[model samples]
Target: VLPHDPSMRPVWMMRIGLFLYDHLARREVLPASATVDLRHGEIGQPLKPRYSKGFAYSDGWVDDARLVVLNAVDARERGAEVLTRWRCADAQRAASGWQVTLQGPGGQERSVQAKVLVNAAGPWAAQFLREHAHIQDSKTLRLVKGSHIVVRKLFDHQTAYVLQSPDRRIIFVIPYEGEFTLIGTTDVEHNGPVGQARIAADEIAYLCEQASRYMRQTVTPADVVWSYSGVRPLLEDEAANPAAVTRDYQLELDTRAAPLLTVWGGKMTTFRKLAEEAADMLAAPLGGSRGAWTQDAFLPGGDLSGWIGTAQRPDGDFQRFEQALTLRHPELSEPMARRWARAYGSRVELLLRDGLGEVVAPGLYEAELRYLHEHEWARTADDVLWRR
Candidate 1:
């Protein structure tokens, strides 16, 4: 934890702090102005955690589109038809269930019949209800905006800083994309179209100013390499503060007329659990459920098992798995081997196909791009870079 005032060090924890430098390097004690000395002209202070040890950090970043694509792929592998680029024009009540009109790309319309209707359209769930009446529209969505800025690397160390601003909001300055620092997150009510969500100038300035107060180097708007904003679909709680709003999700099952399920406001962290609960709710009415099976199930491309180690230097069977991969392939490069260990896990053979096949870019291969296009639904350059 980074305290704004140097005197806060003694206030938070009296037992002198440890500034974690790396996996094997944790400098002990404090000489008062450690931030100024360690970070060189930074204006923040670090203190020892009340209960030391068990401090961890992850460098995991999910490609949002890839996550969706992979889930769909997994579903398809488990025998489910997935149709993308299809828009639900309307859903009319039918004798048995619902007659959903799906408009596909290149001017084609199809009908999909479902016994139960589930609205998981994120921020557009309520709007979808209004335009396409599947049930009595009573649910509301609280659109909260969250923005993040990627800038040139601020700190040399892997340990990220959680900065508390004067406004009482905390922002994170974490290493991003290897050569950049990712700083974020302002919670404000959003009114615009969710598709048009973008970082506001004030938000960028706020992030920059807040980060600059702690980082050794001063960061300005021009220093920002890229910025993005996402609208969080929160449940309408009538909360005065957007940040104060609940992140918990609410599932409404209206079985009066038919089985109409409305998914409102869910945190990504508990998505799997929420999904299992949702399945249980919908299943009992339809026929029956298999109960919660995902607890023991492994996601596609993720089957490796072992105890997790320190964040910086993770110790697991992953290393042995990679060694096995190298032994099997015999031609997979060091960096590609590591990438395979992370990205594909045990399913790397499906990716290597013939070989990592013709370098299209650093750490990216032509075969991978083709595979992404053929399987992962990557259509454009942005889809390949930003999505997949």
Candidate 2:
């Protein structure tokens, strides 16, 4: 976090917060937060000269789309029926369970019964209950649209910057996709259809303005190569400021008749914990084990013990695995091998077991495309391009 001024109050407050965060848990991989002189280092090169000092902290980022795909794959491997391009047309509570009518592509419909129904439809959670299940929920969701703009790479270094705007909102300037920089996120109230959520002109200008405040190279709307927006279904907490709204989630389990669990709000950081708690809540009604098991289990392709000689840390294991893969497949280039390793991890073997048939696109092969189609439910070119 960077201080707008040299005032002692903001710096002290930040120090206290960082101290608490550093000692909050046992951090094995990341280092503790510390003070840094931004003026004399590469970290401050991209920022204006005014940003002379800031506190350096450690955090991790995830490929959210890939994470969801992996979760679906893991669920399928565990005997769960995974469906895509399907929606619950109607759901009625029965004495036995929930009778659900799922509508699929081409106007096809199928019926299924479930002992419990989990409404994790994100922004559409409330809508699903009201329209599909015909349930009147007192609890509501505050849909906040967050927008991000990707521009040509702003900095040469890998370090990400968290710039505090004059309006008290913080914006992240992070390296993205090797060729672009990602500057984001404005929190504005969304009152439109969830599917129609798109970045507005004002949002684009706001992002550019905030990003330009810190960057030596000014950002403008014309400079934006791409922009995306999504509605966050935040639990209505009555906070006047959209940014002050809590990111915490709440689970409402209605067992009055048939079990209906509705997930109100959540962020990616707490998804696993939320899932574990949700599972525990539904276990008693569904007559399943309440024991938690995901903590130790690796997601699909995360385990590299099968290929690596030593069972070391995940980063080390992955590096060794990538080297071993490159040695085994001499035909694969350095960039292609690394990309496959990072994308599929140990599961790249499954993709390569059958020889690469054709070059579908630059750096894209038929083998990988087929793997995604068969395993990850990638149906179209857009799905493969965006999701995978």
Candidate 3:
């Protein structure tokens, strides 16, 4: 079992965002950077969690789903080939190692052998294991569907709300992509193909009903311009409600036949940590000398040295940066600059590599499009526009 840190509390994610926003408001511009230092082998420190109402919760980020895509892109950057439209056929243990077969778009077949096979398939981990690995007695992965809705902006404040629902779910009325209000998420049990996930009519009605209880403007289904669904693969527990299921992760090591590691129940914030642990478990059977490594490493485009706009530089530095970006990419408005600064931060350098030249692509640039395709395994333009 992994060690627990008592310094952490059962604080909701909204509270974390509120804390950041509260800190941001006092300054003229966002800090260019901040860093966290920690002591190794330290678990319990002190538990001090914020509890209140009407607090805004967000990273001031416009597109939250892009965070997931960024990590996938990072993985590809680290030399993992991302194949598209290929489905797994059979995976089992052989004398040499685990062999996995893949079926491509057509009736073609390909097989490969690996020292370890990781089940990072999200909601389909268990199902994938059942079909590929002949492991009957395995940990079950409970698929819980969470849905969100996008509505017309209701509040003038840029801050997002983390309001409490009567059913104990925390709903976010976040300021979306500078144009709409994003709110959601109902945790309902699901058992189906993860690719076919979508927000249901009832889920839409439920979200609107819940948000209407707090906001000045009453929300209805018709106001929703967009909606989405993601399946949280929770570790199966005896919890009565799907919401009560633990978000904590569990790793099952199958060295009984060969070294196969299956992971379930992890958050976007904790995925790097999860990957490290899974890699460590496979180290023994894979005969690797490699040790855990991702803790202190920065994810792609996250290595700005100061708070975003707080560098002790020339006057109007924030304005200068925004104006420079706008001049370079005319497609981006002032609000888009604001959005890009917060989301990409120092990583904006990666997107603006043309040195103030005319924008090669519309809305976003061709360099970014190529980067997302080459490094992040983005197969389509929609993945770039929507997910990125």
Instruction: Give candidate 3's error at residue 37 in angstroms.
Output: 33
User: Distance (Å) between predicted and true CA of 375, model 1?
Assistant: 2.1
lDDT-sorted candidate list, best first: 2, 1, 3
Off by over 4 Å in 3: 1-65, 305-362, 365-367
Higher-scoring candidate on TM-score, 1 or 3: 1
TM-score (C-alpha, index-matched) for candidate 1:
0.82
| lDDT of prediction 1 | 0.73
Candidate that would win on lDDT: 2
User: Each candidate: what lDDT?
Assistant: 0.73, 0.90, 0.67
Which candidate would rank higher by lDDT, 2 or 3?
A: 2
* lDDT (tens digit, per residue) of candidate 3 on 187-295: 9888778878889999999889877765546899999998989989898898999989999998888777767777877887677788788877877887775787776
lDDT of 2 by residue, 1-388 (tens): 4534553348778889889989995678778888888788788788789888888888888999989999999999999998899899999999999999999988899999999999999999999999999999999899999999999999888888887777778899899988899998999999999999999999999999988988899999999999999899999989999999999999999999999999999999999999999999998999978489898898999888878866767667778999999998887889899888888988988898888879999989999999998889999999989988
Select the stronger candidate by TM-score from 1 and 2. Answer: 2
Which is the winner by TM-score between candidate 2 and candidate 3? 2
Which numbered prediction scores highest in TM-score against the true structure? 2
Q: Give the TM-scores of the predictions, in the order they appear.
A: 0.82, 0.96, 0.74
